[model samples]
Target: MSTEPTASGHEAASPAVDPPAWLQRIKSNYCRVCGSPLKLLKPDGEREWRHVCGSCGYVDYHNPKLVVGCIVEHEGKILLCRRAIEPCRGLWTLPAGFMELNESTAAGAARETWEEANAAVKVLAPYAHWDIPVIGQAYILFRAALAPPYTFSSGSESLEVALFAPESIPFDQLAFSSVSITLRLYLEDLRAGTFRLHHGVIDKRPGSQPNDPGAFVVRDHMALELGGASATAAGPGVQEQ
Candidate 1:
């Protein structure tokens, strides 16, 4: 969906909308394991419909993919790539892509940076993670620095690659929601001279169409969200210890 570049902070409203392209469902006709036509079934004790094979009993799971990326800082600038492919072609974004098999998240992040930016990086730590339920993707980004003899060029998937200072970042022309959120938060931390893990959700705005980029809401920390409890809370299974 078409939208103006969102500002630097949390949006006011976040309404869950139907996922584009039916992301929550598997559209493939054949099972990956046995090449048999798949059937949608809940299976015994399963809650969600899964594509399962009656012949091989192979269950096709539609798990959310991990899109790993890096916020590589060199000479106080962050690396970005200009896409040469569709789905936001010609837009600038962090060096990221889908994680590959048999690799750790950090390794995948590093690999993506190299593949798209032609830059070798040393990952420092986990920096941010954002869940986009609308597209069934969870972004795992990292803090990194350019490795020895820092140099870069555009890869096959990128039309160009470059570094941008915080003030010079192309906020309005970022390719994806995840990239914008990562860069904005990174810049905030840079100004504060402190770094910490960030987590958030990107959900559809109320009344938004399928083509809209949706809205972002800060979720703070997952442990804080799931662990905090009320002192006076009472429920069907409540018992004071």
Candidate 2:
């Protein structure tokens, strides 16, 4: 995807256009405003799809979600937490979470760190990012850094938290492939004393049930998506790993 630097000079990924036939399905089945069934339209726009419902005027746009996380290092070791939830229970991952409303992206990242690891951190510049889909929700990822000498505690979703040296990273114990790749990249950067930001697309659309065109679901709060990485494949049952 071609990305142009916005006014902030941050590279923004170009939007992807879904199949036009899907747009037709959306226009015919969903009301432009409330996403309810559109009953009538005297003259629908030909160039653009538009339906104004008497109840509401909700414009639907395919928006990608933003996520954030940090690669916290201490004493030549990186921090990871074992998950206690489904999808990849008993697997290790970096501390991360979703961004909440009324909060900056960095603040959300910090909050997730505090919630998951009980550690405070300072937001660093962008590191790595990837576009991925979970069920139906699209996401973006950001890599950050943590302040040093912090202690971690087990959270509601975490079974345990600990730090591991680069050589001792537990690959088989990683919850998601994204987590494994992130750690590998981080260690590579550490060895070279250089950091590089990368972005890619990972599609994980679920299997379609016969005759259920509008059936869609999204799995959130996976460590892999913390900052926009694909946690796992889309299947009938979406889980962590």
Candidate 3:
């Protein structure tokens, strides 16, 4: 049997449920380091409250896991990969995966590019940080220059890899809203010779509510606004939406 992952990493479709508790909960659980019920404090200009470990003074913020990928350019074509596993199996997308612990985000992006497309890339500039709705996943995009023409790796998570021009991008086959929106903005910037990298959030979770507790939404975009000298060689620390 052909093993192909469905969209967004899972084979089955996810229900349009409420946003994740990870971001919605105003209070976090008791801290493991300190055997005490953590204190909740909503930081200024942010959504969810932060959990402060009273005994240890460990402030646990509601930060989502980050995954980074490269939008690689080679011979006037952009590299694309077909996800072999879920949440978006068989869909076309750029090479991307989660950020591993103890590694820099830039390194993680480069690694995912190599693993997914079998392409070596040099990170050029930062792209956008996207928060996938409902799924509670965050992605960081990077502008990269492909080392050469790439072939698909026979991995457990990819079917094939190919390249396409900007006008020929497969919108319907993209993995998620982030991928689609990033491509659109990138293409526009590429044509206009203006690189206006945006710092915002895109909520794709299900349900619609202002403060109904379960309604999906993204907030506190100041994290992404860290630009200029404040942005380190490691790039901005944009938590997933």
Candidate 4:
């Protein structure tokens, strides 16, 4: 199919038929310690194959990344950012980013909100943990609220920033499945007057390529629809959020 830019000034969403190279965790092809070519080998007593340097016996285990984000609320509206970057530019998403060194996950979430939405939020609690094995990313989200005056604007990574009422959420335009899952459950809880920790997995459909339709299967734990982790599961040390 032909492609065109959307009203948001980003390219139309296209099927990721070809495996999205950006999603895959890069495995080392060579050993950094000995500068030797590495081979994928299963160690005698291990359950997984890793890049091993035959010369020095050094091994590199490729690990998934930790992504931190928040569900920020102001009044009865939820905050969202329209991404101005790749992977899913023009798509709407909650403010989030990769966890950085020396920062608690909750702190990371707060930083991301400030960086992407220019809003200071007080993170309240752990919300959900979802593992996207297909993309080698584990998302940890928190519940948060606008700090003080609750002012916000678009950050460098976003084209636009706005608060969305539950019924006005652009579900079809969300950048990631994790965002969809979190928002869906958040809305359900909003109506039900109860909230709890949620755990889920985003699995790749068997025999499907990245760009194939229905390539990923999202599991939702609650009555309606939708959906990994580590780092301060929140409290006093989370003072920054």
For each of the candidates, the C-alpha root-mean-square deviation to the true structure, in angstroms, is 12.1, 11.7, 12.8, 11.8
Candidate 2: residue 178 lDDT (0-100): 51
- For residues 86-194, write the lDDT of model 4, one tens digit per residue: 8788999999999999999999999999999999999887788988876678999988888977899999999999998889999878887788878887777666555
Query: What C-alpha root-mean-square deviation, in Å, does candidate 4 show against the real structure?
Result: 11.8
Rank order by lDDT, top first? 4, 1, 3, 2
Clashes of each: 2, 5, 21, 4
Cα TM-score per model: 0.77, 0.62, 0.62, 0.76
Tens-digit lDDT string for candidate 1 (1-241):
2234455332322223433235334576788888998876667975445678988999987889999998888877778898998778888988888999999999999999999989999887677888877577889997778887799999999999998878999988888777877777677656655565677776655444322355544453331121222211011111224
Ranking by TM-score: 1, 4, 2, 3
Candidate 1 global TM-score? 0.77
lDDT for predicted candidate 1 compared with the true structure: 0.73
Q: Give me the runs in candidate 3 sitting further than 4 Å from their true place.
A: 1-62, 132-134, 148-154, 207-241
Model 3, span 1-241: residue lDDT tens:
2337776465444344543354445446788677777866654664435677878877776556897998887666788898888777778888888899988888999999888777788777677876654555678998777764444464456798887887898887887666777787777665654555555576644554212333434443423223232222222223333
Assess each prediction's global lDDT (C-alpha) against the native.
0.73, 0.57, 0.67, 0.76
State how far residue 40 of model 1 sits from its true place (Å): 1.2
lDDT of 4: 0.76
Candidate 2 backbone collisions, by pair: 33-58, 87-240, 140-228, 141-227, 141-228
Q: Output the worst ten-in-a-row residue range by lDDT, candidate 4.
A: 227-236
